[model samples]
Target: MTVCAIEMTTTAPFTIAADGSYAARLAGDGEALYAERWTLAGPEPYAVPLPLAQPEEADTELLPLADGRVLIHRRVAERHAFALLYPTGAAAGPRTGELPLGAVCAEEGGDVRVRLLPPSPDGRDAFALAVTGAGTTVWRVAGGAFGPEQVARIPGRCSGGVWLDRVGRLLALDHELDGTTKAVAVDLGRGGEVSPLLQITEASDDRLLLADPDSGLLLIRSDAPGEPRLGWGVLGSSLPVRFPECLRLGDAHPFAVQPGQALMPETSGVALRLPDGRIGLWRPADRQVFRFGAPAGWLGGTGLWSAQGRLHLPYATPEVPCGIVGMSLPPAPPPPVRLDPAPPTPTRPIPLQQAPL
Candidate 1:
């Protein structure tokens, strides 16, 4: 789907805000984790002026707070602790004291923690579906205010979850039970009750990629479609979303889009397996896919969508170790007027694997 390809110069890799104004990165000093915030809007962009410094620990995971602070999870021994960094200087740029996440979050054990719960609609509050060895839990993280507070703990073992509504009220999580993965919804309004969301009659992990509240549109990649191809399903609607077997959306952002927020809705650039397994972006909106001539060692081939629907992907050439770049897609091309063309021959419905769809 070639419209007009714009040049994307490489830069640092960071998690961008809803509007792509600022970016955040997790910096580690071997013992401590630092939350580095940069203003990508100013002339001198990517400068980590106001950095949040966390207490020294063995390992740390950082998530950006809406108010520019950070929600830090520090792993000291077997005890799992949470803290809120104010990001101080003139602004709250860095460092923190102990602000435990109560008794529930004191253990960050097992295979996974919070995977993707999407930030609040206005970027003020953040929600996450935290998965531990015990079970999966939902936590509400508010920047500049409180640490991670338990909203509700889901039933059974699960991978992660996504927000289904614009106001961050509804959530959909991938629950693993009985040797199969099912999409279940945990209605926060209903006291964290779990109900079936998307279910396939097979053993597969159907993770929610992006759910657009404005249109109730869902993009999911699951092994149910033979080999985890990109498929569409509508929220609150029982109708199944079906796609051809030839398409395989490569490993892209499986994280949920922020409430009333999307990196790119109208168009998306997904990673794909092409040109000797190089990273590529698949635009589902237009059924067009393009590959970038990025140097080897791209950031795990995960593509990001910006506020304006621009594609920001990490690339590393031989000269540059790592950097991020944004691809501005031109408007969708006009459809060609119909003229009766020769009918094509029928072919077998051969299933194919497509990554980054």
Candidate 2:
């Protein structure tokens, strides 16, 4: 099928707010930060320039905070830090904080939770959260106010981390162990106990790990084969159902399905990744599909989410530095038109009356 006449623009990191508004980032030509907001209703996007208090370099890890602010992870050689950027004029200066981990990954919630390798004198592996707090002494101290927790120290590198629940009780860790890679879900609230959710014995790489906050359905990707394959299972279940067939159905990259959204009970959402790597908004109930194109060189690995009734894609393309490209789903297509073949042309009438004359 040919792509319909719809143009997709490149966008930066974006998130759907509680009120259904979308907040996205756009860096200007000179690398100045700007924030753009768009509504679900069709309208031209509006942007606001954000000023940097400190002359720090660009940080790619942009996460939206629950309190309408954005968290940026800044790396300076071996030192890692974080800064909070409020919307437009909400705050005077950027809130900066130092972290123990050489690198930090953040997830916003009631509090901005950062997963960073803890400061270990012996070079042991650790992950911890640096919670926002009071003045210098109150925040500067490590492991006291909001410090690092050594969850599971393995022999190799820690690949991925995600919170399994709202309260952050269960932590999912993707790490390499015994020359193999696996995803292990650990109960952090009870203790640092770990249990295997999915394992790969052969030479494989875990590309992505996504957990539904509501349903607890865990989706994982493995590069055991040349291309990525999706596998999903319930939180505590060991039996993972591999959707190898889903991968064969075109360029279907995995998109995250929000809780309580319209989705297949077995699967989530009506969206399907086409063979060409474009996302099709699908409604299996209605048997309808709408296609949306991504910016030129952008791959679908960027996280896609449907929250507050809008489809938000935090994609990075070669054209646009960073922003969220969103498009509303159009109404279902009408029934196919049927055309009957033309009736056979009538032959020339015979002139028998001329013979009688």
Q: Best candidate, lDDT-wise?
A: 1
* lDDT per residue as tens, model 2, 21-113: 434344444465444333332354344444455443444444443344544455554434544555444354543332342233233322333
TM-score for candidate 1: 0.68
Give TM-scores for every candidate, taking all chains together and pairing residue i with residue i. Answer: 0.68, 0.57
Q: Which stretches of candidate 1 lie over 4 Å from their true place?
A: 1-13, 28-33, 41-44, 49-58, 90-118, 128-134, 143-147, 202-204, 236-239, 249-278, 295-308, 313-324, 333-357
Clash pairs (backbone) in predicted model 2: 11-323, 12-322, 12-323, 12-324, 250-275, 251-274, 251-275, 263-269
Q: Assess each prediction's global lDDT (C-alpha) against the native.
A: 0.51, 0.43
Candidate 2, overall lDDT? 0.43
Error of 2 at 91 (Å): 11
Model 1 Cα shift for residue 98 (angstroms):
8.6
Residue range 1-357, candidate 1, lDDT tens digits: 222233232322345554445555554345454555545554444435334333343234554555565555555544445555554344442333324453224363445554434445455565656666677787665532456667778767876556666555677677887677777777776678777666654566776666666545566777775676667654544335555343454553433231222322333333443534544554445565555554344443345555454665544345543355655555645433423331221111111122332
